[model samples]
Structure formats: structure tokens, C-alpha cells
Target: MRKMLDLLSLKLLRRIEIRYRLINSFLLVSMLPLVIAGIVAYRESSSASQEKVRIFAAELVKQVAQNMLQQIEKIESSSEELAMSERMQNALAGYYSKNPAERAAGHGEIIRLLLENYGSFEYVNQKYVLDRRHRIMDPQVFAQLGDGVARFAEDAPDMKGRPYWDVYSTAAGQNSVVMLRDILFKSNNRVAGTLFVGLRPLHFSRIFESVNLGYGSRMLVIDARDGHVIVSANAADGNAPESGLVVAVARNVAEGRDNFVSYRDGDNKQQLAAFAPVPHTNWMVVNITPLNALNTEVRSIRNKIIAIGVLCFILALVLSFIIARSISLPLKQLVGVMKATRTGNYLIRMDYEGRDEIAVLSQRFNEMASKVHQHNERLEELVAERTRELEQANHQLEALSATDSLTGIANRRRFDEALGGELRRAVRSQKPLALMMLDVDYFKNYNDRYGHLAGDDCLRAIARVLRTSSRRATDLAARYGGEEFAVIVAESDSANAMQLAENIRNAVAALQIAHEDSPFGCVTCSIGVTAVQVDEDMSTDTLLRLADVALYQAKALGRNRVALSDPAGATG
Candidate 1:
């Protein structure tokens, strides 16, 4: 009985030890991989997302700030021009010059100046002058200044000081933007009157509207003198706060440390702010974006890792030892196969048993392999097709480039090339060559009367006549340029070339195209023929010029006529 009990206890202990060892091994094996994968995924995702967010934010801020700087420059230069205006200075001198009649006369001149050039000054809403006494001199003129125009007359206690821009709400129920200047005399350099121009803030906003930052980001121009938001897309939100961020950023910006800063919004959300100062104005621009919105992927990745960890723990407890071994062995094989994909062997695949994620992975690998094979096949086919297409395209391009668009004949460039070769050949073989030049008569008036379509038909008919009249295989026909054509005949004498020219002219005249403006009482062309000789130093340019001169003589003498030039003394 004692021996039997010892054997049974030993067997039970072995079973318990095996279960514990299996559980521990499987847990360590499965959980370690999951943990490593989670850590690597989180790190890679964070790095990529951060890089993308940084570039997007930096570019957005830089472009918006640069555009606002340009607008500030325009406004400053324009204000300088307005301050130096002769009519404006004379008007201010009249307003502050101690006589009511002079002031009235100055007012009339100022009104005429504003009215005469109102269209030119689209940005300036109204112009006004404050007298030395600081009293409201012309209420009618004030009415014309509109409710948005703010005037601090020279007589006020605050008016004893210097020139500055004042932005405030006016009694005229307008948001007034005003520039104040102490007008001076060029001779004595004394203060004349306060020259003020009132502009609406809305004018500045029109320029800002064209700049794009991002979908939810904004470019804000805030007054450094005050916390008022001047021009911004966020102004329409109605819930955006009057920013203390602007004041703090402007102070830092003035000290030359223009770096990005973080702040909280009215909704208590954290945001990133970047700003720059406009050089001549008491205004700074701010670009703002929500920080969380920018780095949203970080939170999403963390949540996913936690969820995966919980799932792995459940799976570790449920799977049996033998089953876990089976899964682990296949997984190791799959990892090796996946590694092969990085080396471009996309044909590698894993063997899997059950219809789970791993099985789906196996199926995906097979599909990917199939697609790669198909893509390789398709790539080869595409390369073949593209090669054939390129050859055909080359042929078509050669034809289109050498031939005329309207007349289906060789064009001037082709003619130049051909003439050079033929001249060389004629010099080598001691053969004669002839050139014929022809022009349309009354083509411009024919176009004006019957339209360009009829004019094109007439040119085409003339080209056809020249083509038919020249019957030799060595003859070449070409469109020289607009309303002009030429032919080169090899081994043809001057007598035969002149006869061919007459034949072309008669063929075109026989076409019966009407030209009421024709000096010959019919639609016709002028022809010039010149023969090239062997001993003569004949070149393409020289032959073309001689033929052109003969063509000119034909037109000058009378239309519907042919003229010929002897080229016996032609030179290179």
C-alpha cells in the first residue's frame, strides 16, 4: 500500500508541474511579442505624426505672417503720399490760417479735391482738416466726413501734442480708423492744421481674406496698443475671447524673441500660437491652432495599445499547450515570411490552419503575391504598348512638323532644309535648278468681306493649282508663309520655269474666287520665276530674295500677272 501511494503522488506532482510550466512559457512567449509590437508601433506613429504636424504648422504661420507684413507696407507708404499732397497741405493751411473767409475758401478747395479724385482714393473713405481753434467750423463738412470719421480738432486739450493714428468708435455710429498729422509749411516749417484721413477697418480685412492657413487655423491682426482683434477669420465665431495672449506675445516679439508659445482658449482648450510684428504699425499678427487637434494620433495609438494588451491576456488563458505551440510555430514561420517581403520577395506566404486573423493574413499574402505577378505581367505589356505608341507618335510628329497646316505641302522650314541640300547637289553635279514665288491678291479685303473661311479656301485652291502645274517628280511645292507659296524644280531651265509660273497663275484665276478689291477686276495671284545656274554662287537665301523681288515687281506693275528674273549672275 505504501509503494502504490508513492507512485500515485509522483504522477500527480508531474501533471501539476507540466501545467504550470506550460502556462508560464506560453504567457511569456505571447505577451512579450505583443508588448514589443505595441511599443514599436507607438514610437513610430508618434515620430511620423509629430514631423507632419511641425512642417504643416510652420509653413502655415510663415506664409500668413509674410502676407500681413506686405499689407502693412502698402498702408504706410500710402499714408506718406497722402500727407505730402499739395492740395491737402493748402487746405489745412486755409482751415487753421486765422480768417473765416480763407477757411471757407479752403473748405471749398478741399471738397473739390476730394470729389475730383474720389475714384482714385478707393481706400480712403473721407478727408478732413481740424483748425487751430479746435472748434467745429463746418458741420456740413463734418456730415460729409460720415459717422465713421473721427476728427480731433487742434483746439482740444489733447490736441497740443504730436501726430498719431486714433482708432475708436465714433458718434456717427461708425468704427473709425483715423491718421492724424500736423500739417507744415514748406517755407517756414510751422504747424498749419491737423490733416486727418478716416478709413474703415473693413478695408484691411479684405486683404486678409485671401490668405489661407489651414481649415481650422486663423491669421489674427491684433492691436498692440489695445487687445482688440482687428482682422481675423475667428472674429466671426462670436465666442472667441479677447486675448491676453496677444499682449504677452507682442511684448516678447518686441524684445526679438519671436518664438511659438502655448495658451488656453475661452473653452479651456490648449492651443499653439505663433506671431510676428508689422514694422510701422502698432499691430501684431497671431497664428493659432489647437494643440490636441494637431497631435490627435498620439492619443489614438495609446488607446489601441491598451485594448490589444487586454485581448492578449484573455487569449493567453484560453489556448491549450499543444494548440499554443502550433500557433507559435506558424507565427514564427509567418514572421520570417513577412521579413522576406522587405527584400522584394513578395511570393513568400505562410501556412495557417484556422479561419482567424493569422489565416486572413495568410490569405492576404497570397492575394498580394497574385497582384504582384499580375502587375509584373501588366508592366511588361504596358512597356511593349508604350514602345509601339512612341514609334507611331515619332512618325506623326515628323509629318506635322514638316508640313503646312492649311495646304498639305512642305512648310518654310522644310523648304529651307530642302533648298540647301538641292543647292549642294546642283553644285556637285553641275545641274540647273529654278525657284518660283507666288502671292495672293486682295487676300486681306477678301477676308474682311467673305470671312477667313473663304480666304483659307482661296489659299488652298492656289496651293492645289501650283501642285498640279508642276508635273515633274523632282519638283517640290511649299507654303513659304502667310499668303505666300514657292516651288523648286530640279534641272529646269528659265524658259520652262516662266511657262510653269504662267500656268500656275492662270490655274488660280480659273478658280473663280471673287475679290471685289482686286486691282485686276478678278481674284488672282502674282508669280515670279528665277532659274539657278551652275557656275553662279547660288544659296537658298539669295535665290529666295531674287524670286521675292520679282514677285514684288509683278504686284507693283499689275495684279493677276507673272514676272520672271534671270539668275545667271546669282552669287552665294
Candidate 2:
């Protein structure tokens, strides 16, 4: 009874240790790499999102600034045209050269010229001139806006026949975006008068109306000179917090950073901001959007990675427990089989169903024990046969590992090996070699239109074409990666490589795979061809790089065509 209890305790302790070791080994081996990959992917994806937002925001703000410049430039141009006229210049010099009564007497000519020139222009909501006496030439036109217009001219800088823009609202509820310019005399270059022309608020409204900056977004036209906001699209000056947009805009205007991005907008929320300077004016257009709003895709990727890691963790734990129990039980059985074989019961075998190392060891032991004395003469022949079988199995396994299972073509590992070997042989023979890289055009759209299973079939079909096309013994066709295939031709020059590439492109297009998403109404490919006379200086990496460059050129020029690399390592 003591022996039985001791044996039971020993088995229990061994099982516990085995379970602990298995769980620890599996978790460390699997989860550690997964955790590292998750972290790397998350950080890279985050950085990419931030960069994309920065570029997009910079472009959007630049477009807005350009639109605003176009509108303002039109107003400035019209006012300059009116002010540059000989009659208008004479009328201004005559009015400002006289006393208040005489000026008032000749001001009718100024008003008549203003009415005749800009009166018919619908955008000219308000037009007048400010003189030395602060008198309004058209009091009726100025109405409740006279004081505001005069103050603007007083506060504005000295304009020597140039336009200055201001945004204001009068006490009588008249709002105008007015342009101020000085009418200079031809002889003395003195300030004849200040021209005031106003536009409606809706004039600047259309510039910001069409832009969608997303939720919790803000768009402001900031004066670059003084860092004050001229107009806001979705924000109001009085009610706004003035912390987020104001701070970012202040930085943008101060630093002249048109591509500034990724900052806390002072609302305790992360935000992305960009600004662009408006041409012909000292103003900048700023666009600010919440980081979370722009990071939705990044967040989704992160969450999916986290979920996959968690699921893997749980599955690993459960699998560890199951594997531990299975191993422990099988080890006990294997011991029993060994004891029976020691007593000459060689027929006893372990009934294990696994492909692990333990299974292989047990199978070897079973075969050795069963054939120990039964076939002494035939043992040598049997050993020879098993050795041959093992070699054949190894060859099959190696081939499987080097080939892409989905496409039934040589995989990236095999492609790399082939390329290296081919370069060496070419260098020895001083012969030229050609490489072609082919990509299924618009494959992502194709997969989105069809299912992934169909995509796999499509790749297999392409691989069949590659297999048939490269008929030479020295030629190798490989699946470089998803939707990308490569071909290596020995003793080939650039012209032949290009011809082969064209053939491949045409063959792919002729497949007639219905791809509604593709422009050709059928599946097509783009091929990049590069051939170089192998020398001691040539490397596989350089060849692959050249081929990739040519591939990008093919994509740039248009798909469904082939591009060959030039001698200067550019597209031919």
C-alpha cells in the first residue's frame, strides 16, 4: 500500500510539472512574438494615420486658401481697375485738392464715376471714398456703415495704390467684407484718397461651406499679420473656447508651418491641425479636426489586434492543457511498450496519432523492436528501402515548403534562391539575365468585388500562364507575393525581356476574368522588365530594385502594359 501511494504521488507531481512547463513554454513562445508584432503594427499604423491626416489637411487648407484668394483677388482687381482709370484718378485728385465745400462740390463726379463703374457689379454691396475730412462721398450709401468704414481706413496700414481687406459689422446690423486702397496722384505720388468697397458675408461663406472637416472640427481664416481670426466657418468668436483653434492658428501663423499636425488643441483632446497662407493677403486658412475622428481606422486596427491577441492567449492556454495531458498519458504507454519489448513481446506497438517529435521517436522504436530478429537477412534491404522512402518524403516536404500552395508556383523563398543562383551563373558566363515582375492591376478592387476564394482562383490562373510561358530549362517563374509574380530568364537581353513582358500582359488580359471593378472589364496585369549584363559588380538586390522601379512606372503610365527599365536605372 505504501508503494502504491508513493507511485500515485510521483505521477501526480510529474503531471503537474509537465502541465506547468507546457503552458509556460507555449505562452512564451507564441504570445511574446504576437505581443511584439501587435505593438509594432499599432505604432506603424498610428504613424501612418497621422502622416496621412497631415498631408490631407495641408492640401485641404491650401485649397481653401486658394479659393479665398481667388475671391479676394477678384475684388481687389476690380477695385484696382476702377481706381487706375484716368477719369477716376482725375476725379479723386480734384476732390481731395479742394476745401470741404469745394471737395463736396466735386465729390458728385467721384460718386458718379463710382456708380458708373462698380454700380452694376452685384458683388459691390458698398462703395465710397474716405478723404482728409473723414467725409463720406455717398452718405446714403454709407448709411449706418460710415463710422465703421472710416475707422477701418484709420486703423489700416498705408496702402500705396494697393488693396487691404477688413471684416466688420456696423451697429445698424450691416456686415461687410470691405477692401481699402489708396488712390495715388501721378505727379507727387501723394495719397489722393482711400477707396472703400464692401462685399456681402456670403462671399466668404461659400469658400468654407463645401469643406467637411469632420466632427468637432473648426475652420478659421486667421490674419497672419496680427494673428486674429477674420472669419470662421462653423465657429463663432464670442462663444468659442479660443483655446484649441486659436493656439494652433497662432503657432501656424508665427511659424509659417503649413503642414503642422498632431497636437493637443487645448480642449484636453488630441487634434490634427494644418494651415496654408493665402496669396496676395496676409492671412492663413487653418483647419483643425479631432484626432479621434481621424484615427477611427487606426483605432479599429488596434482593437482587432488586441482581440486577436486575447483570443490566441485563451486558445493557447486550452491547447496547452490538452497537449500536456495527451503527452503525459502517451509517455506512460510508451514505457509500457518498452517493458513488453524487453520481454521479447516485439509485436506490442504504441497507437499514437500525432505528427510531433515524440510520435516519430515512438514509431522508430516500434519498428526496430518488431524487426529485431524476424528478418535478419532482409534487414539490410528493408533499411535501404526505408532510407529511400525517407529521402523521398524529405524531398516532397522541401518542395512543398518552397512552393506557394495557393498559386502552385515557386514561392518567395524559392524565388530568392533562384535569383541568387542565376546571378552567380550569369556572372561566371558573362551573360545577360532578365527579370520580369508582374502585378494584377486593381487586385484589391477585384477582391472587394469578388470574394477572396475567387481571388485565389484568379491567382492560380495567372500562375498557370506563368508556368506555361517560361518554358526554358533555365527560366524560373515564381509567385513573389500576393497578386505579384516574378520571372527570371537566363541568357536574355532587354529587348527579349520586354517582349516576354508584353506577352505576359497580353495573356493576362486575355484571361477574360470578369472584373467589373477593372477599367478593362477583364482582369489585367502590369509588368516591369529589367535585364542586365551580369558582372562582378551586379547584385540580385540591385536587379530587384530596378525591376520594382520599372513596375511603379508601369503603374504610373497606366495599367495593362509593360515597362522596361533604362540603363540609367529609370523607366525606359
Candidate 3:
């Protein structure tokens, strides 16, 4: 410990001695003060720049959050007024007075009355209705919402008494916020049924988008129910939860706390973002600014500071050159010794033998050259060893990320990346990109019957069948999660994909994996097939969603058959 301390002290002292001996006497004294001033200027400039950025981001976030809050409040107020309209209360009073069809007709008239009275509630992008039975009566209502909203009536039994907040989606696939108000229609002052009026996403989006913000900044209304991002601008549109950032911001908004956050933009290298929550809705407004734009003023200041430092350094150098010859006579000799050592002549010695600091500096330089040569050799060995270890670790991480542990098939992450690349390429080449989403029929029952370990074996067998059936290099079979798997067959159409899926299904059947609890004779699989035509507007997210919707359809229509959605069909 003492030796190490002594070595550190000597090294610092050696640098100081070299500075004084080789530099001009006047400039050497001035260098310390100049360096101190430069440091102070750099620190102050950095602090001011950082503070400015923080303030700008915070102010921007606060403004956006406030705007969003106002917009949602407006929508909520509009919903309230529509719910309290006389037509709605009158319709609800007689809702149970007649059959479902009569109730629907009455509800439609009430909705029309509300729309005629309040123009704000009528929008092309929203669906408004009062749903009593499994049927919904609306002019613009989506056919898909018929089933989903029908189930909700059962979910909320007390919905007939008072106004309750119910959210739903439009048939056009946009999110809709519905306020269900109890309507008491009375020819003789008695309760009737219920009235449901909806506030559209576009209404909120228009209001949210009206707020002025910086470039590339966006306000998005997201549905926390299913992670469907309803209204967004200046971002890739999709429902996938890539990061928990939106969910976290949505939570903050729900809690009525306007907070600020930062994250990296995935699309660009230099982008940084700050996010804030919009109150009273599942909405988050993010302020995105490129680092280059944010730090432009700071960078200019840094460049100017560097330029000044260089000019001062040049002036110091000239002054040192003028007065250094006589005082640096020993340094000139020591420099010659260093030059000799540079040419592999370390045997050469400095001439100074005086009992001064320069003499000690010269002695230390001679010792330093020897130590540096030894360290160079050892450092090279250490660097090579570390490089090899890093490469190995990187390879391991890549493998673990791409390969599923249970079935040894490609994982969802790998499938997403690889299939996205292939889809882009196929689209460019004007070839079809085919996808088949497969799920083990009654795999949950299989797990219940045979145990989880046997379920693992069943999955392994199924994965092997899929891998074997997709023999082409362009075909990729990936484990989509749990008992679900997906195959991306590039340059193939719907017919070819269906054939490939059928082959895989048959191969799994041939494995004869017996399951007495299986509804389908033995362990079987259901398949959903979809194909994306080569087109300029085709997107990876949309294609995946279509395939997913088709998969759901396949499961819904009997469990052991194949189902396909129309290529241009809207995804749920």
C-alpha cells in the first residue's frame, strides 16, 4: 500500500516538474489560472443548458396535459348533456314496455333526437346506442361490436338504474366512450329502461390535436382495456404493447397526477422523448424532441469555448517557444533521449544530473519508458481476452433471445423481427407473404389431464412437426406463446399457406399423441391462414393483426377446423 501511494505521488509530481521545466517561466505560471477559468466556463455553460432543456420539457408537458384534461372534460360534459336530454329519458322509460325490436326502435329515435339537438354528439367516427338485449340499434354501429357489447349487458346488471360509464369501440375499429344514463320515460311519471349515449374518440382526438406543440410531438388516446392505441399522430399505429411507457402514463392520468417522463425513440438514433398524462381519459401526450435540436444552443457554445481554448493554447505555445530555449536546455537533451527511446534505443541516457526537479523528471521519464513498454504487452493480452469473452457473451444473449426454451423453436421476438423483414422484402419483390397461426386444440385440457410435463412433451412434438413441415428456407415456424405457434411462409399465397398448415396438422396427427380428454379424437390443432398481397400500404403490424383475428375466428368456429379472414377485412 505504501509503495503504491509513493508511486502515485511521484507520478503527479513528475508531471508538474515536466510542465515547469519544458514550458516558459511566465506561461507556466499563467496556465493553471487559464485552465481553472476554462473549467468554470464549461461547467456553467453545461449547467445552464441542462436547466434550460429540463424547463422546456417540463413546460411543454404541463401544457399538453392541461389541454388533454380540458378536452376530456368537454367530452364528458357533452356525454352528460346528451344523457340528460328529454328524448333519452322518455325512450328509457318505455324500453321494457315493448319487445327488444321495439326498444331498439325507440332507442334509435332518442339517439336521433339527441344528435339533432346537440351536433357535437353526432360524428362519423363514433357509434351511439342503447343496448338492452343481445341486439344493438345504431345507424353507424359496427357488426363486430354486436357480440362484444351484448356480453357487457350481462356484465353490468345495475346498468338499468342510473348513469354509468361504459366504454366501447366503433365498428370502424375506433374507440368509443359511452355514458349509459338511466331513462325514466313516464306518460304517468314512472321508470322505463336505459339510454346509452357515446362520445367518440375522434371528438377527443380533434380537441387533443388542436393543442400546439413542437415538431414530432404527439397526443394519443389509448384504450387501457386491451392496449389499443385509439388516437395517435406522428407515430407508427399499432395495438402491441412494445413498452410499458404508455400504460404507465395512462395510470398517472387516471390517478389525476400530471407527471413528466423521458424515453428513447426506437425509430431514430438521436431522438429523446418526454411524456405526460392527459387527465380523465386513457390518454397520454408525449413530447418528442431530437437531441440535436434540443442541444443546438449548447453545442454552439461548446464549439465557441473550444475555439477560444485552442486560440489561447496556440498563444501560450508561441510564448513558451520564445522563452524556453535556455531554461529548457536540459529538457531538450531529455527530449533527445526520449526520441532515441522511441527508435528502440532505451539504452540512451538524459544528460542532466543536477539535484533539481528537472533532473528528477528526467530520471522518472527513463523509468517510465521501461514500465510503459512492459504494460503495453500485458494490456494487449488483457484486451484480447476481454474481447473474446464479450463476443461469447453476446452470442449467448442472441441465442437465448431468439430460441424458445421449451420447444427449441424460434421465439415470438425472433418471429416478429424476421417475419417483418421478409414481409418488407416480399412486398418490394411483389410477392405474397403468407402467415398461418396455429393453436393446439384443447391443450389446456391436455395439461389438466396429463400434467404440465406431459404438456411440454406435447408442445415439443407439435413444434417438431411444424419445423419439419416448413422445410423451405423461406419458411419460419415460431412459438407464438403458450400453445400457439405461427409460421411465416414468404413468397406464398393463401392457398399455399393453407396447404402447408394442413400438412403440419396431419403430421401432428400422425404423431398419434393420444389425449383421452381431447375433444378432437387425438391431440389436434386449429389453423388460421392469412396472406398479405404485395402493396405499398401493407404494414407488418396490420398483417399480424389480421392473422391474429383470423386465429380467433378459427377458435370460435369449432376448435379443429381452419379459418381464414378476407385479406382486406378489418381486424378486431
Cα lDDT of model 3 by residue, 539-569, tens digit: 7777778788888888898777777768776
Per-residue lDDT of 379 in model 3: 86
- Model 1 lDDT per residue over 94-115, tens place: 7656654576677777666555
What shift in Å separates residue 62 of candidate 3 from its native position after superposition?
Answer: 28
| TM-score, candidate number 2 | 0.42
Cand. 3 Cα-lDDT: 0.66
- lDDT of every model, 2 decimals: 0.68, 0.76, 0.66
Q: What digit string (tens of lDDT, one per residue) describes model 2 on residues 1-572?
A: 65654454334434444546566656564656555776787778777877876777788898998899888887788777877788777777667663544555467788898789778877667778777655567644434567767777788876545687766666766667778888767777776777887777666856888897564567777666555667777535432333455566666657866567556744577877788878767767878777777667766776676667767566665555555555666688888888876666667778764555556768988788768747654777889999999999999978987888788889988999999999999999989999999999999888887988899999999999999999999999999977889999999999898988888888888889999998889999999889998787778888898889889999999888899887575331
lDDT winner between candidates 1 and 3: 1
**Superposed model 1: Cα runs more than 4 Å off:** 1-363, 375-433, 442-454, 470-475, 490-496, 512-521, 531-540, 556-562, 566-572
In candidate 3, which residue pairs get closer than 3 Å at backbone N, Cα or C atoms, i.e. clash? 92-193, 93-185, 93-192, 142-171
- TM-score for all models, in order of appearance: 0.41, 0.42, 0.42
